[model samples]
Target: MASDHVAEFEAHRPRLFAVGYRLLGSAAEAEDLVQETFLRWNDADRDVVRTPAAWLTKVLTNLCLNRLASARSRREDYVGIWLPEPVMTDDSALGPLETAERRESVSLAMLVLMEKLTPVERAVFVLREAFGYRHREIAEILDITESNSQQVLRRAQAHLRERPRFDASGDQRRRIAELFLDAARGGDLPALERLLADDVVSSADGGGVAGAARNAIRGASRVARYFAGLLDVPLPGLELRVVELNGQPGILAVVGDALVSVTVVEVGDERVRRIYNVVNPDKLRFLAAQCGLVARNWRQVIEDTSGSVMELRAARFRE
Candidate 1:
């Protein structure tokens, strides 16, 4: 009987992982939460779990909400800017990211924007918006009234709306991404300007261990200059690979066997609106694993980076 119960939980493990990962951006943290949930499930009486999936979801959601609440203050003291661990995602990992709405829910931009939501709001938003849970189902999982769930969802949507999220379709983004990379590859000033929007913003996450822009660069010309300058000083054995990141096209930079960075862009109107450069070595583990390579060695990665923009990015990895 115990083994049967364990098998049932294992069957839902992927779904549980998805719930945890989307709610909490760190894959490592999500694995921890899922493992804890399994322990609780093992101890639970099988007869009492009328719907195992709902029971596990409720448990996972609460655990993530608690973690998010605590993580807020820690992020405040974080070294430099903190970005979500870039994931090389698949259909089973987060969900079928077939539609723009579904895909954007798990996008880096969306994950970052979720920071603004209150713990309850975040829970409601993820459950209702991403998972398609009914208000009553969310109410049960969150231990709130149906009306409260609806109100929270409304507030979450409104708060998110105030913050503009890039809504460009995949086809639209791919078109702009290819051109954007072409300009950025050679540091083409005129081409970079033509590809960027007037009010473009560029941000990087070095986690203080890696060198990165301490502050966001705004305006098209400035954004253009930032990337052009970065590409100007090429690291030895630098290789660029085009890949899909969180349902949108992105670039992966590898030096020999080590991954240097994963860059993604938000595009609209045939111009790039935002550029997200993730240079933190700690966050590239999954990218390295995906590319069948190891992360860049600290010493080797910094060889040509001295006196360059990368030298500025060699910030400490803030835990």
Candidate 2:
């Protein structure tokens, strides 16, 4: 019986983590919630549990909701712009990214927009949009009426209506990232400006620990000069590699075995619209450990950039 229980939880672990990560936007917190859910599952009366998956999801989601109340308080006092902690999505850590919607649901842009939502609204939106949960099912999980669930979802959508829509295809996005990388590294302000949209915006989250722009930098020319100036200064042993982050093309800055920063962009009409750089050491711990675990030698992976980006996809890193 114990073995059977363990097997059932194992089967649902991935999905639970997916929902948790999306709700909280912190892989480390999501992982902790998942473990706590398992403890509750073990303590619950299995005889009355009709569906294990639903039970586990409800437990995890509520855990996240409880955590979000406190999380928002922390963010209010957080230093600088607080960006969602990014995870390498090459291995589908947050769930299947086969569709554009699924990918967008977990993207850094969407995650940032979600911060504006109320806890209940965020829960309803994530359940309906990301996991395809029916209103009736959502009502059960959230202890609200079906109509209330639908209304909450609509409200959440309204809040997130400003989310950027990317016009670039996967290949185009990669190409743009590559070009941006080259231009930034070479300090080519003209090339950077040409690639940026007129209203391009750049924001950095350094958690006040690492040096970063305290305020968002806006406008194409200003943003271009910012990156040109930022990247032009050479730091010895700093390596930049283009890789998929949160299901979209992004760049990773690393020095030796340490991850220094992660940059993800939103492109529309083949022009870069928004650039998000996360340099907070606290946020980089999970991804940095992932890097160390997947690649035996970071230099080898960094040197071989000729192949497709998929070639460097980190094998699913387990906690």
Candidate 3:
């Protein structure tokens, strides 16, 4: 019975982790939630639990909802733009991302947009949109009326309706990213400008330890120049690679023993609409570990470093 129970819990671990990651935007936190769920499941009466999957989903969702409530306050005072910790993921991790509707739910851009939602709304949105939970089931899981679940989901969707859709396929994303990087590297301002949306916005998240813009930079011309200037003043020892982050192709940067930064773009009509740069040391641990490096503050080592943007140095791109 004990072994069988463990097997049952393991089968649903992926879905639970998916919900936790989408809700909280932290892989470590998601794994922790999975552990917590297992603990509770171990003690749960298997016969009464009836549906292990549903029970686990409810437990994980509520756990994430509580965390999000507390997290919002902290983020308000965060050192810089708080982009989601970029994770190397695929459709198996975030569900089929081929369709805009499915992909949007996992995109870092949408996850950031979700930060604007209330905890209940965020839970409702994640459950309904990403997991395909029906309103009645969500209501049962959340302990809310079915109609209430529907309304909350509606409100959440309305808030997110204006965010850009991720329409580019994997090949297009890789091609566009290569072109953008090549232009930025060669300092070809015109080529970059042509690839940027008129209302393009770039956000940097260095989390104070690393040097980054304290505020977001917006506008096509401004953003294009920002990247050009960034290339003109590159950080030293920065190595770059192409990785799938948050279900999309993105650039990851590692400097020395630290994961310096990650940049993921949202492309529409074959042009970059938004660029999310995450440089927070706290958020780069997983990636650093993946690259066999330590995610630490190397900024102190090069505090006097000048004429270079601290986010990255001369980058080497690997597919």
Candidate 4:
């Protein structure tokens, strides 16, 4: 009986994590909620539980709603612009990214926009949009009427109506990221400006632990010059690479084995529309572990590399 319970929980672990992560936007917190859900599941009365999946979803979603309330309060005192904790999606850590909509649902841009939504609204939106939960199912999970669930989703969608959509193919995004990195490193403001949209916005979230811009930098020329100046300064042992972040092409900055920051670029109409730079050490913990940078000799791999910019794939990192 115990083994059967364990297997059942394991089967739903990935989906639970996926739902939790999208709701909270923090992998660490999502993991905590998932563990708590498992604990509850262990003690749950299986005889009365008609559907394990729905029961787990309700438990996890409630946990997230509680967390989101406190998280918003804490963010009031948070230092600088708080960006979502960046995660590598190549391994499907946050669930399937086979579709553009699924990928956008987890993007840093959409996550940031979601911050403006009420806890209930965010829950409804993520459930319906990301996971395809019906309004009736959402009502059950959220303990609201079906009509209320639909209304909440409408509000959430309206709030997120401005969310940027990336229509570029994966190869196109990678090529653009490569070009952006080269231009930034070489201090080529003209090239950078050419790639940026007229209203491009760049935000850096250092979370008060690392140096970053407190306010968002806007405009193509200003954002271009900012990156050019920032990346032109050479730091010994610093490496920049184009990698996949949250189902999109992004830049990872590292010095030795330590990850310095993750820059997630949003591309629209083949131009860079927004850049989210997360430099907070606390936010990097989960991703660093995923990349095997924790207590590993990954620095030796960097030392062997010839150039500052290269492709860092998941397999290469594990090797």
> Quick one: best lDDT, which candidate?
4
lDDT of 3 by residue, 5-71 (tens): 9998998888788889889988778889889989999988777898888889988888888888888
Estimate the TM-score of every prediction: 0.89, 0.90, 0.89, 0.90
Give model 4's TM-score versus the native structure: 0.90
lDDT of candidate 2 over 1-319, digit per residue (tens): 9999999999999899889888998988998999999999999997878999889989999999999999999999999999987888887778778888888899888999999999899999999989999999999999999999988988998889897576678899989989998998888889999999898889998888777898999998999888887664335566899988887788988766667788997777998988999887778777777777221222333344323223333321221
Judged by TM-score, which candidate is best? 4
Which residues of candidate 1, in runs, are more than 4 Å off? 1-3, 90-92, 163-168, 297-300, 304-319
**CA error at residue 287 for candidate 2, angstroms:** 1.4
Listed per model in order, the count of residue pairs whose N, CA or C atoms clash below 3 Å is: 14, 0, 2, 0
lDDT of 4 at 134: 96
Q: Taking the tens digit of each residue's C-alpha lDDT, what string does model 1 give over 1-319?
A: 7788889989988878777777887777887999999999988877898999999999988999999889899889878777787777653466677766677787778888888889899889988877899999999999999999999999999889844455676777787888888888887989999988898888888878778888989998898888987776646577887677776678888876788888988776667877788888777786677678876534447575554444545532221
Model 2 lDDT at residue 84: 84
* Winner on TM-score (2 vs 4): 4
What are the per-residue Cα lDDT tens digits for candidate 4 across 17-120? 99998999999999999999999999999997889999999999999999999999899999999998889998988888999899999999999999999999
Residue 153, model 2: lDDT of 87
lDDT of 1 at 1: 77
What does the lDDT read for residue 136 in candidate 3? 93
